[model samples]
Target chain A: MTATLGCVTLSLADRLTDLTLSLHEGEVTAICGPNGAGKSTLLSCLGGLVAADGGLVTLGGRLMRNVPVQERARSIGYLPQSPEIAWDVSVEVLVSLGRLPWGDAGAKIGRDAIEEAIAAMDLGALRNRRVSRLSGGERARALMARVLATCPAWLLADEPLANLDLRHAIALMRRFREQAGKGRGVVLVLHDLATAMNFADRVIVLDRGRLAADGEPAHALRSEVIEQVWGCKAGWLGERGMRALSLG
Target chain B: MNRRLILILVAALVVAVPLSLLAGRVWIDPIAPTTRNAALILFELRLPRAALALVIGAGLGVSGAAMQGYLRNPLADPGLFGIAPGAALGAVLSFWAGYAASVWLLPVFALVGAGGAMALLALIAGREGGVALFTMAGLMIASLAGALTSLAISLSPTPFAMSEIVTWLMGALADRSWREVGIAAPLTLIGVGVLLSAGRGLDALTLGEVAARSLGLEPRRLQARMIVGVGLAVGAAVAVAGVIGFVGLMVPHLVRPLTDRRPSSLMVPSALAGALLLLVADCLCRVLPLSGGELRLGIALSLLGAPFFLKLLLDMRRGLA
Candidate 1:
């Protein structure tokens, strides 16, 4: 699947500038930027949650604007930056809601899909558990299970790894890796440069609503790019794929 | 447990309906119809009144469930959207203008008022259907309508009209004929139907607005459904029965633990629970030996709602403790 942002722009006080990029399926692409860097806005624009003032986003060679919402949702499962479960429903119930795009939410969630999602999130024991009783990491996994149950073609999560502990964060990245390995599109809006460097096939960095760098993780989030974009004098501590950010 | 609870509510309704028809000031003997006007009273007056109570109560319950679900606020109510208050304003204006003398004009005026409020809410929400903006718009409309209703009560041409306005605004299904029932039943039924269709949308919204939209829930469509649904349902309730309160707020909470707690599943049972509650409450109001004419349904619900609210507060405090 080819996901392209054709100079996508927004007029909401220019929350997003004339940004353009093309992302491919079977790749874990991380959108990395500081706060207010239009990362979330770009993710939303690509997910078709926000309309752009200029340019466009297309999925699988079809213009996103022309795609009907339900159809679009069938192909795109979106998890917000901080997903909120309004009701204290069971994790199973929460996951089943992903079937909403399929017009078969709740009890209509197919057995295979629900079971796979639950297992994918390691939530087999917590399936019947109410969300209010779950820890933050458990709740986050449950939220991911919900999006996974949709079995969408494009899985876009905003800061999905933000609040997780180290173990859960890496576990979640592996899940994204697995999804990408399955020939699906996986896009994440992440603020952690090291995580992006370690886990992302490619990284796109933004600064001040504009694209700062776009390339492989090592090139896009290199020392010079971080200096130019984040205004932080930083260095990489480790080597190659297992690198960590070290500040001066 | 969910299915059983719904079944229990249905059974209660089945039992309660005949009892409501029988438990009024003039208790009807089911075995032998003796009084000359027993058939007249039972068929004409009591039946319509009972039907109206069920219809209005169901409407309020569904509207409340939908509103709470859509807004992601348990404290949310259909009345907060201003349709009920707007309808009440229309009815109050009909009282002030003395057009309530006609059989149809009051509900008609209330319907028009509900329509106006709906239009204004739509205008304020506009193309940007942000939940915060939509909610504020609703609260604003409710406040304006409430103030206008108060003005109508105060500026009544005569004390008689003022009393009439106040009494009607207190909310009652007493003396409602089949005509009121006829007008409300279809509109409310359609309204509930519309909200039920939005059940999935409300469920998806548990993930919040942007995520819900990404799930294919066009917020504006859901917003429109809510306005039309709540407007018709709550508007019809206020038009026919006056400003009845608390049923919407209380019914879903009372039934929440019984169901899966999904916003969509909550509506039907809440509607059933609302109907059963109003029927029993109205029966109690009729049977209670009150010095004043009869306990108004609105006041009765407030009395019930207040205790539930207190219990909720105490429970929350205890949980924290």
Candidate 2:
């Protein structure tokens, strides 16, 4: 099912203007913006983690608020930036928390999903280790596995690549692409423009709490738009197809 | 692994119970009773006291674990939210008001006080309050309650009443009978039951309120349950045992390492460990060669727990450094 936000305005002191967008199934959408652009706020609004001051968010043609929490949880997985792990629980057990929405089904599907997510994140070796003992990057991947284990229709992640090393970051982006290929909508709040350009099918750029640009990565990352919205000068150079943006 | 821990805890409890019963001022030979007085001491005094110690310890332990899990702070205790001090104020008020002679009035008043404190805590903390706010509010309420209690004590009409209040505040399980056990059991059981059932919600909460909400766990509902659970358990425990300190805060820390630090897994073991610790402490109070009367349970716990707390603080400082 597709997720849509219609003229959603979230005001937490600063006003986020009318945000209207439709996120289709089977597409990886990267949200990009400068600091305080309300990118994370918009994602939170769509995910129903925060209430909008005005307007509506709907998933699968149903009002987001009207959807039962358990149903919404099963259908959409949200991984917030810097998710705290209060306890030193084992990785496998922490990941299994994702299956809580499904109570007492045959254990096989839950086990399979947990194993697959762990494998996808290359955390099999650290599966039994305490989450508190893991490095920052390992913990991020472990939490990513927790989100993926839910196997939701829509996956919302905020700054998930913040602590990951280069190899793990690339692996995570590839996994997001695979999730999109499998008909799940993957929306990420990303700061790395190069990764967004390389992996995201569509890009939504927020500037000063408003949607500034929304289109294919090539179009949305246009030099003029980047310069205007991000206050930066951008140019593509080298055979590696690197897009560089320097503050003007 | 959990089963082994549980087994070890249960075994320790089994051993501790009999020892607690037999290890008082007058040694009771349970195998062969030397006199009717010994049996009377065993049945009338030690049995009920040991039972009270067990239940109260379990209550504090489970409540502490639940609070820590809910607040996502290892230092979180049942008393951290002012329930114990609130209950203390209620009992003190009852004494000052000349109702200490009534058997049930004191606990009933204490429960009411605990409920009032919890309501105030919730109101001050608000809908989206974080740990810092809750803890700060709790400290404020506790200080207020403690001040009121001291005022009540100072204004007492009789010096005898003031001493009674002092004794109660020191906290003891002495002279407790089956009646006190009956008063504390059901509420503690129900409170522990409520806290135990919130394991999944607590696990989700480790991900923070927003993520927990996204996972379909209602943070408000979970928090409400925790409040009720802690109120009932701690309030009842204070009613019977008179504000025993540190068991709630210390037991979870002791058991968390063995249980892999999973909040849900910590509850039962914490409960068991709390029971064992209190029973042992009570036994030590009886056996120790104190110059005055038998040492109060609360004092003993603080003496033991203060060192542990200091070490924890130093370790935390080191980690920060």
Measured by TM-score, the strongest candidate is 1
Residues B1-321 of candidate 2 have per-residue lDDT tens digits of: 888999999999999999888897787777887866887898899999999999999999999999899888877788888989999999888886677468888888888889888898888875865657777888998999999998999998899989988888888999999999999999999999999988888878878877887788876777778878898899999988898988988999889888767688899999899899889999999988788779999989989889988887887688620
Clashes of each: 0, 0
Locate the minimum summed-lDDT window of 10 residues in model 2 chain B. Answer: B312-321
Please list the residue runs of candidate 2 whose C-alpha ends up more than 4 Å from where it truly belongs after superposition.
Answer: A1-14, A104-106, A238-242, A246-248
True contacts kept of each: 0.91, 0.86
lDDT of 1 by residue, B22-44 (tens): 88888889999776699999989
Error of 2 at A75 (Å): 1.6
Could you give candidate 1's fraction of true interface contacts?
0.91
Model 2 lDDT per residue over A1-248, tens place: 12383222222213467767888778899999998998788788778777665666777777777878898888888999878776778998888878777642229998998898899888999999988789877888888888888888888999889878888788788888988898888899999888888888899988997788899988898788888897778765433335544444
DockQ (C-alpha based) per candidate is 0.85, 0.76
Segments in model 1 whose C-alpha atoms lie over 4 Å from true places? A1-13, A106-109, B313-321
